[model samples]
Target: MTRTTGYEPLFTLKPVAPEIWVVDGPILKFYGLPFPTRMVVVRLTDGGLWLHSPIQMDDGLLQALAALGPVQHLMAPNWIHYAFVPDWQRAFPKAQTWAAPGVQERAGSRGLALRVDHQITDHAPDAWAGQVDQLVVPGSPVHREAVFFHRASKTLILTDLIENFEAANLPVWLIPLAWAAGTLDPDGKAPIDMRQTFRKGREAARGAIETMLSWEPERLIMAHGRWYETGAMAELNRAFRWVLR
Candidate 1:
């Protein structure tokens, strides 16, 4: 199965911890879209599958997932990340849909019908029964963020919280902005918009960051930037220092 349309797959299977795989694509350069957003695939204990943040579905990606096992669960970590849910649900109709709290209402406002099998809350960790650990990053209505950790991989997965851009992929005009925002390299800069978004709940946001940092992830996967393999927890702490203060 190969659905090659809007974008080509530039697959990088990051060994964040162990069984977890971080699949991502080439960066969408023109508009500061660094890396084709990442999607986390977890191999469940039952040999079933659980997917977090389903990227745009293509036959190729779909086939790749099928090879893993039965995709029993599809999740929308937050409101802004639901664009590809319809296609994924169509592809795996038997898969149960899960959404972060408020996601259904948000989807309804967007005129997208969502069949959510469950809604994630602060207690999602217990609800998920150690299969996955979820935390609510309190900030941004558009984001209403949910961060995930795959116990099998010891990997922490996040969307939009940290974006690390590749210099070559950025347009000349956006390069300076990217550099300043900390998307360029090891300096650990948060994107300007991300900075603004984090300001909404300084204390709450910091607490969330602290909670994730406490997990001590071996690798960090971001939706819009490069994935960090080493010292990921340190990088995350550096990038979010502003919120800490």
Candidate 2:
């Protein structure tokens, strides 16, 4: 059970964009089923790093991240992804933690005293200004995913919005379940149950998608499964086809 954060087998760290890096976290059980998790790192204009959806940080990983830049910001893209915020906050005491709406309340409910210093809205913060553009995909009551675009690298970063899990990568029994949910590879999409929840806020969700498309991103960095390096915009439109229709 050493899949998620806290008890890590160590996360693999690598560079994904010009100044952005990633730590591929260990697979954790989602509803008793295995699921992959990822954490993204972006270097801000002021020579500090902005961490998105931070994963388990071991000594080695911390050292590696330090080599990239000063860790100045820690972001929780959604409520469900805030579990690791406390760990990162303690590790980087000076870093500001940005919350994605409901995260503060959810963290409190889970008995975790998370320090979320700022809220992530449509406006890009001064630290990441000119480098990253942000959008909040509003729909589900319990979650609101914050998506970011790296202007320099033409990369779009997302969490839980567009998931494309390869069938071979999943446990045998879970393959059918993922496939039925429209989360399987070759044409990865968001979870069907999650999409159904958009009925009440479909317009807001569409607005977010439109904003993402406006960026004309060349690559996509997802928090789950494989990422898209080419034709990213096309894939985004395809993944959110239901919302668009």
Q: Per-residue lDDT tens digits of candidate 2, residues 207-237? A: 8899889999999988887788889988988
List ranges where model 1 is wrong by over 4 Å: 1-17, 26-35, 125-128, 180-182, 188-190
What are the TM-scores, per candidate, against the unseen true structure?
0.83, 0.94
Count of clashes in candidate 2: 0
Global lDDT for candidate 2?
0.84
TM-score of 2: 0.94
Q: Report the error of model 2 at residue 138, Å.
A: 2.0
Candidate 1 per-residue lDDT, tens place, 1-245, comes to 43221223445444445567767754333343444567788887777777888876666667777777888888898776777788889888998888887788888998998888877766653335686788888866555778887666668888767767665555567678778776675554556776787566678788888888888787787776566777777888788878875
User: Which residue pairs overlap in candidate 1's backbone?
Assistant: 27-35, 182-189
Model 2 worst lDDT run, 10 consecutive residues: 1-10
Model 1 TM-score on a 0 to 1 scale: 0.83
